[model samples]
Target chain A: MPARVIVVTSGKGGVGKTTSTANIAAALAKFGKKVVAVDADVGLRNLDVIMGLENRVVFNFIDVIEKTCKLSQALVKDKRVPGLYLLPAAQTRTKDAVNPQQMIELCEELKPDFDFILLDCPAGIEGGFKNAAAGADEALVVTTPEIPAVRDADRIIGMLESMGKSPIRLIINRLRPNMVQDGDMLAKDDILDVLSIDLIGVVPEDEGVIRATNNGEPMTMTLDSPAAHAYLNIAERLLGNDVPLMDLESYTSRGFFSWIKKLFKRRTRQY
Target chain B: MDFLRKLFGGGNDGSGAKAKDRLRIVLIHDRTDISPELLDSLREEIVSVLSKYMEIDNDKIEIDLDRDEKAVALVANIPVLRIKRGNVDYDKV
Candidate 1:
């Protein structure tokens, strides 16, 4: 069977597009499925670093597209996971170095060998975003619970719909539960109300993500924190497992209040 | 201080509720590609056209662009006091 090409994108930068791609790909690989994390963010490639395969990148995405290297040669295998690979993006070349059609063709060549092909898209609705999205069968939009992020995400969803991409799912990242309860940050319900898309996962704000990135490790590998478990659950859901969304109260001070809110929500849905 | 503010339920300056309201307005404008001035003009035109047939409460009239996942529409709620029937004061009759 052909691999499922999934592009992880967020129009706004620093919203965890690359991180989600890396962690989810790693989690999938850990489940013994063949996965490739393609860094489509040319000139700003961090997917390789996050997967701890930076030092092994002899050839990059542009190299494969330009026909300078075979696609297999460019795929840097992860020592940490059995079936994970990293197709690093060129750090020196700009986004225009490759086009959308070329990306589609590259994924076509990779489809037969891998079980999943994850594209780590660059921020902004530009050449990089076009190139990343051109080849994917599905889109996983990563967003933070902020006004600008949600607005950009809504725009991205609209664009993806116009392009006729089906099953576009959302991953809400960096949610500060404490702030959410305090009415200082947008809650999960608020983001869903605005974006109006099927949600795949929600990762709570955790400093462990930063630490894992600095160490060139995917947080899911250690599964040490709340965010790690969230990423793993996302992987499970992507694999067609019906994993329930995590309870936000566990990360908040007003647990009983949030529980009451949940009970009220359930009761309202019964009607 | 936080507890006092919570108890009194007043110091919600720059809160998430305010942010949601702001985003709602901005997203509607962005999706419809309509400016605030354009919306104002549209409202004025609608009011003028409706006034030709009936006495309308312009101040009470509500006009907004509502959107969902599938469609967007202009929803207007104009209060009508009486219908003007070809130079006849129907309300007085």
Candidate 2:
């Protein structure tokens, strides 16, 4: 069977589009499925660096499209996970380097070999976003719980609906539970009320994500991080498994108790 | 501070509610491509055209885009004071 080409996109930048793509692809590959993470950001390629395969990107997707390199040669295999690969985008070229038709054709060529193809789309609903979305059978729209991010996500959802994409799912990233409890940040229910899409997963704000990125390793590689568990659950849900949503309130209450214990310990030591 | 306010039941309507309200209005405009100014102008044009045939209570006129799950409708509630006498021939038949 051909691979399921799914584009991980957010209309706004810095909402973890590339990170989600890398982590989900890695998680899927870890499950023993063949997966390829395609960086379709064109001029601003970061999937290679995020996947920690930057040094191995000798050829890119553009090179394959232009017939400068074979598709297999352009694909950079991730030694960390079996059956995982990276198709880097050319940093020097502009988004106009490839059109929607070319992207569709590329996905066709990749379909037979891989079990899943995840496209890391660029920000904005311009050529780059359209090109990335053109070939996908499904979409994973990522958004943080903010006014601008949610508004832009709504616009993207409208566009995806017009394009007739099936089963558009939402991933709420960087959700701070304490803020939501304080009625400051938008809650998951509030976001769903406006976006009206299927919820795939919610990744809590985790400092470990920064460290994992700096090390060129995704959060899913380790079993300790909360964010890693969230990403793995998303992979499971994508595979048609009915995984329940992560209990964010448990994290909040646990944090509160830990803080109170630390404060009591400090006061006793001060005496 | 936030916890204290929440405990006092003072800040229940925080910025989250404000954000949701603002997004609701903005998205309606975005989806229909109709701004407040555009709606006002449309109401004015409708009032003018209706006033030529009937005496309408202009102050009570309301026009808005009503959105449901499937479609948006330009709903107008125009109050008429009286119909003009010479605008129509009641005995034309």
**Model 2 agreement with the true structure over B2-93: per-residue lDDT tens digits:** 55544444646767788777777777767786888988888889888888889999888889888764457889899999999888677983
**Interface root-mean-square deviation (Å) of every model:** 8.1, 5.3
Q: Check candidate 2 and list the clashing pairs.
A: none
Q: Give Cα-based local distance difference scores for all models.
A: 0.88, 0.90
lDDT of 2 by residue, A118-166 (tens): 9999999999999999999999999999988998999999998898888
Per-model TM-score versus the true fold: 0.78, 0.81
Q: Model 2 chain A: which ten-residue window has the lowest total lDDT?
A: A262-271
Per-residue lDDT tens digits of candidate 1, residues A46-120?
898887777888999798888898988998988878998999999999998998999999999999999999999
Return the lDDT, model 2, position A91: 95
lDDT accuracy of residue A45 in candidate 1: 89
TM match of model 1 to true structure: 0.78
- Model 2 spans > 4 angstroms off: A254-271, B1-11, B34-93
Docking class of 2: acceptable
TM-score evaluated only on chain B, model 2: 0.60
